[model samples]
Target chain A: MSLLAVGTLAYDDVYTPYGEVKMIEAGSCTYIAMAATYFVQPVQVVSVIGGDYNDDFLADLQRRGSDLEGVEVIPEGKSFYWAGRYHDDMMGRDTLDTQLNVLADFDPKVPESYRKAPYVMLGNLTPAVQSRVLDQLTERPKLVALDTMNFWMDHALEDLMAVLKRIDVLIINDEEARQLSGELSLLKAAAKIVEMGPKILIIKKGEHGALLFEGENLFSAPALLLPKVVDPTGAGDTFAGGLIGYLAATDDLSFANLKRAVIYGSAMASFVVEDFGTRRMQTLDQEQIDRRVQRFGELMTVSL
Target chain B: MSLLAVGTLAYDDVYTPYGEVKMIEAGSCTYIAMAATYFVQPVQVVSVIGGDYNDDFLADLQRRGSDLEGVEVIPEGKSFYWAGRYHDDMMGRDTLDTQLNVLADFDPKVPESYRKAPYVMLGNLTPAVQSRVLDQLTERPKLVALDTMNFWMDHALEDLMAVLKRIDVLIINDEEARQLSGELSLLKAAAKIVEMGPKILIIKKGEHGALLFEGENLFSAPALLLPKVVDPTGAGDTFAGGLIGYLAATDDLSFANLKRAVIYGSAMASFVVEDFGTRRMQTLDQEQIDRRVQRFGELMTVSL
Candidate 1:
């Protein structure tokens, strides 16, 4: 089964208490596509970049099994560039700059070859962009998982809800779930959010872990405890990518499989936060991933 | 194996978003003894209560299998009284009043029979008072676990450290662990805290769950997702009580047993927050306790 991912591709500068980085290869799709490739081959990317985008980076993604047919390059404009500084706690950050040069008038163009992809991951993007990717798809993918942030909830709620109705799963943070559902309790928020759209809700809590809710059934996945969080920039997108990628690989949509997918997602995010940007994410091996996944089981299991 | 608990016994006035309650049975030892009796026999309590303490409450505790021979009556003073208003979150509270009448000058006197209790639980109290109880014991217990809070860390670091060195296990919340260890990351905090004293460290994160760390070994427990948190007043103390109680009942001090104890502790705490103070904690039967403990197993288990 093919997996398609649509989101941003950019150059990011992250400043954190652990350290700082400049001009790292980043963006929602960059992390998503990379993480997705770990479980599924040929992660089809539909994103926009500019002439400033590194050709070597594109080549590297392709070499690692990404289909970049729909990744448009605006030769005259600079690529999307973002700068952020993480607070004392890496849980949050302040966006210093978001220069959406090539992405300003961005139009998601799905290649015909990728239009029939059976799995689609709508990474954090404007609701309109996320919905547009679906509109271009030849058929409704077997599973459509969308990731969004609170900015859209604060600004484009109507648009966000429109996209929600068309997706099967929604992967957002706990805070966003509360804001969108107008409920303080995560259980209530999950219930309210499911009624609005997406039957499956994955509420990510930075270090605490993630919660998976489908109807009355609920599963809590603990985050892999890292010795230190070097950078948290793309941890969430990487989590979503690994989740859908594992689902796409296994082709199992049962609640049990979804639970396994979440564990895999959590394991992948553990690697993402280990190093700045996608440095560690891009270098992961199956053995390393397997060990982390195993650790999650051991960390959570108590024979009682 | 007998389990002993020593700490405050108070009348608490709690106000929350759901509603408010007048002076009810509360305090560290109250919740501890109540939660402890469900897993172990003869939960021995050593504390000081004023004449205002209800005789029926004492009889009720005794009826529920608590040995309150060490609970002294200070007829000249009022019982310890605490008034707090829980914010909407229910995870924390603002202590509006803490009129420590008898407790201000509390000098715990452990009964002769309890001096041989193999399992000892030192609930949140002045480190000086907790040490006094241990110093009065004729024989050393097989396992000694102490639960403390941020207040002690702030006002009596030396005293807190003094007690830490004498305990076999330390059960405290995430915030207190960070404050005590002077480390942010829990992994690092666990390592630093263990070096200072106890070999086993249990870090409790209210709604998130708890972490059991012993040397290089670490286990994560998920909190039972509640429909709504009615009150979180005695949840932590209840958790500690359940942990030591389970440990004492099993009579195994292995890390594996400690891990199971943490889960049982988590299950016991799930009931504590269901209602204000110890209202829910006091009424739990063995069957109800078993079900919640089983639910925690199911909740945390993911067959990978």
Candidate 2:
């Protein structure tokens, strides 16, 4: 099964309590595609990157089963860049700078081969651009999951709601959930967001864990608590990518399968945060992933 | 098996988004004894109360199999009183008033019959009072769990550390754990805390859930999501009470049994938060508690 991943590809400078890394390859799309490729081949890439972007990274994506046919190259233009410093707690951060270059006018065009992809993961972007992706698809995807942030909810909520009606799943963090639903209680917030459209909603709570809501069913997934967290920039996007990729490969949308998928996705996210800027994702093998997931299962197991 | 519960008996005026109540029955000892009575009878209560305290409430505790012989009543004195207002999110609150009338000079005296009890639950109190209770014990209990707060850590660090070295189990909220161990990471904090004394440490996260750490084993229990939380008073004490009560009744301290006890404690805490003060605890039956715990098991179940 093929999956279409539409989002940004950028260069990031990050600072954490452990150390600092500069000009690293990072973005929602980069993390999503990398995480999804582990579960399904040919994760079609639908994003824009400046010519200055590393050619070696492109080769790396191709080697990992990512189709670059849909990726647009804007020569003489700079890629989107962001610089941020994480607080001591590692849960909060401050954005030092943001330079939207090629991404300022990104008009995503889905390649013909990707239009009929079985799964789609729309990483954080403008709602209008996200809706454009859905409008170009020739065949309905088995599952369409969208990841968003408080930025879009604040700037383009009307358009966001328009896209919300077209997707099968919505993934966002806890604060965004509260902002979207205007409710203090998460249970009440999930109820309100599900009414807006998607059949499945995943609310990610950074270190606390993630909660899944489908109709009357609710699943709470516990996050694996690591002794150290190097970086957490793309943990949420990686979680979404792993989730959709698992569903596409298994082709099961039942609540039971979704529960397992949440655990798998959480397992992937746990690995991403262990190192900076998708470093852990680079050399991960199936044996390592399976072992990590087994640990997650053990971490949550309790007969009573 | 009998359990000794040493803490304060008081009245609480609480305000929540749902509504507000004035001078409602509340106290650490009251909630602990009431929750523990579900599993073990003759929950011996050691607390100081004023003549103004309700007679009906004391009679109610007796009806629920609580031994009031250890509870000292001062006819001319007033009870400990507190008033607080919950913020919109319900996780935070500001204390409006505190009147430590009878509790100001409380010197807990464990009764002769309760001195040799198999289980002891030391609720939030002055470290000196808690230590005095422990000193009065004629025999070492099978399990001793102590619940404390940041106030004691800030004011009575030496005494708190002294008491910490004597308990078998230490239960405190997440923030308190961080403050006590000076570690932001809960896993690391738990490690540092176990070295200080207690063999088992439980970190309670109000709405998020609870964590149990024993040697190399860790159990995460999810809090039941309630659509409406009237007030969250006495939740932590209730959790500790349920846990100790279950252990006392079952007489099992194995790690596996502790895992079950966490869930059982979490179930009782979920019920107490549904209404103000101890209204829900006043009317809970064994069937209700068992059913609630089964739901907790289902909430955390995932096979991957």
Model 2, span A60-99: residue lDDT tens: 9889989999999999899999999999989799999999
Docking verdict class for candidate 2:
medium
Cα TM-score per model: 0.98, 0.99
Per-residue lDDT of model 2, residues B53-78, tens digit only: 99998999999989999999999999
- After superposing candidate 1, which stretches have Cα over 4 Å from the reference? none
**Model 1, global lDDT:** 0.91
User: What tens digits encode model 1's per-residue C-alpha lDDT throughout B106-223?
Assistant: 9888888889888999999999988998998888999999999899998998998999999989998888888888877989889999988899999998889989998778899999
What's the true lDDT of residue B22 in model 1? 87
Residue B23, candidate 1: C-alpha displacement in angstroms: 1.3
Q: Write model 1 residue lDDT over A1-304, tens digit each, in one string.
A: 8899999999999999989999999999999998999999989999999888899989999998999999998898888899999999676789999998998899999999998899999999999999999999888799999999999999999999999999999999988998999888898888899998899999999899999999877898998777798999999999999999999999999999999999999999999999999999778899999989999998987888
State the TM-score of candidate 2 restricted to chain B: 0.99
lDDT of 1 at A174: 85
RMSD of 2: 1.0
Per-candidate DockQ vs. reference: 0.75, 0.75
Candidate 1: share of reference interface contacts reproduced: 0.67
